[model samples]
Target: MALGSKKLRVYVWFTLPALLLYIGFFFYPALMGLNYSLTNWDGMARTYRYIGLSNYAAIFKDERFLHALGFTFKYTLIVVVAKLAIALGLALLLTSRMRFRSFFRSIYFFPAVLSLITIGLIFNEIFFTILPVIGEALGIEPLSRNILGNKDTALYGILIANIWHGVAVPMVIFMAGLSSVPKDLHEAATIDGAGKRQRFFSITLPFLIPMLNVNLVLLIKGGLTVFDSIVAMTDGGPGTSTESIGFLIYRHGMLENKFGYATAESIFVFAMIAIISYVQMKWLNKQEVGQQ
Candidate 1:
C-alpha cells in the first residue's frame, strides 16, 4: 500500500505541470469563451451586456455562417477520402521490393515537414502563374484561367494543395501499420496458392484497421479546422467561395471585431468537431473489433 501510494505521488508530481498547463491554456479559455459568447462584447467595448444565446441564434440565421459550415463539411469529406486512398496506395508501393525504397520513402515524407502556409503560398503561385500558362499552351480552357479565381474550381485547387501536403504523414502511418503485419501469414497464404489481392484482403487489411482509425480521426480534425491553407491560398476568396469555419471565426473576431459572435462560432465548431469525431471513432472502433 505504501509503495503504491509512493508511485502515485511520483506520477502525480510528474503530471501536475502538464495538467496545470492544459487547464490554464485550454480549459480556462474555453470557459471564458463560453461566458463571453452569451454577451455582445465586440472585443473592445469597456462594458458589455449578457445577450443569452442571441449570438448563437443569429449564427443559425446568418447565411454566411451557414455557407461556411457547409463548405467546411464538404472540404473535410473530400480531403479525408482522397488523403486516405492516396496515402494507402503510396504505403503499399513503398512497402514492396523496389529500387532505393528508403530514398523513395524519405522523398514521399518530405512534404509533411513543410508548413501548410508555405505549401499554400507555393501552390497559389502555381495556380496563378504556371497552370494558366500550361493551360494556354495545351489549349485547355479551364486551365487557361487562374483556378483560384473561379468559385466553382477554387475548392478543387485547395484540395490539390492540401492532398499534396497532407498525404505524407498518413503514408508514413500506413507504412508503420504495414510493417507490423506478420510476414508468416503472407508466406503461408502463398504456400496455399493465395494470390496477392487475396492475401492482402484476408491477412494484411485486418492488421491495418487500428492505423486506419488513427488516420481517419486525424484527417477529420484537420479538415474541420482548416485555416492556414485557405488564408495563404485564396484568403477565403473568389468572393467567400472557400470560406471555412476556422477562417470565418478569424475574420469575424480579428477583422470584423465581432468578438462575441466569433466566440459563439468557435464554440459551435468545438461542439461540431467533438460530435463528429466521436461518431466516427465509435464506428471505426466497431470495425476494429469486427476485424479481430
Candidate 2:
C-alpha cells in the first residue's frame, strides 16, 4: 500500500502542472467567454450590462450569420469527404509495390509542411495571375478570369488550396492503419480465392474504421474552424460568399468590436462541434463493434 501510494503521488506531481495549465489557459477562458456571451459588452466599454441570451437570439435572426453557418457546414462536408477519399486512395497506392514509392509519398506530403496561409498565398497568385494566362491561352472562359474573383467558384478554389494542404496527415494516418492490417489475413483471403476488392472490403476496411473515425473528426474540425486560408485568399470576399463562421467571428469580434456577439457565436460553434463529433463517434463506434 505504501509503494502504490508513493507511485500515485509521483504521478500526480508530474500531472498536476499540466492539468493546472490546461484549466488556466483553456477552461478558465472558456468560462469567461461564456460569461461574456450573456453580456452586451463591446470589449472596450467601461460599463457593460448582461443581456441574458439576447446575443444568441440576435445571431439566429442575423442573415449574414445564418449564411456563414450554412457555408461552413457545406465546406465541412466537402472537405471531409474529399480529404478522406483522396488520402485513403493515396495511402493504398503508396503502400503497394510501386517504384519510387517513398519519393512520391514525400512529394505528396510536402504541402502539409507548409503553412495554410503560405499555401493560400501561393494559390492566390496562381488563381490571380498564372491561371488566367493559361486560361486565355487555352481560350477557356472560366479560367480566363481570376477564380477567386467569382463568388460562384470561389469556394472550390479555396477548397483546392485547403485539400492540398490538409490531405497529407490523413494519408500518413491511413498508411499507418494499412500497415497494421495483418498480411497473413490477406494471404488467407487470397488462398480462399478472394480478390483485392473483396479482401479490402472484408478485412482491410474493418481495421481502417478507427483511423477513419479519427481522420473524420480532424477534417471536420479543420473545416469548421478554417480561417487563415480564407483570410489570405479571400478575406471573406468575392462579396462574403466564402465567409466562414471562424472568419465571421474574427470580423465581428476583432474588426467590428462586437466582442459579446462574437463570443456568443463562438460558444454556439463549440456546441455544434461537440454535438456533431459526439454523434459521429457514437455511430462509428457501433460500426467498429459490428465489425468485430
Q: Write the per-residue lDDT of candidate 2 for residues 221-271, one digit (tens) a residue.
A: 999999999999999999999999999999999999899999999999999
TM-score of each: 0.95, 0.97
Q: Top TM-score: which candidate number?
A: 2
Clash count (model 2, backbone only) = 0
Which portions of model 1 miss their true places by more than 4 Å? 1-6, 289-292
Error of 1 at 249 (Å): 1.0
Model 2 RMSD vs true structure:
1.2
Give candidate 1's TM-score: 0.95
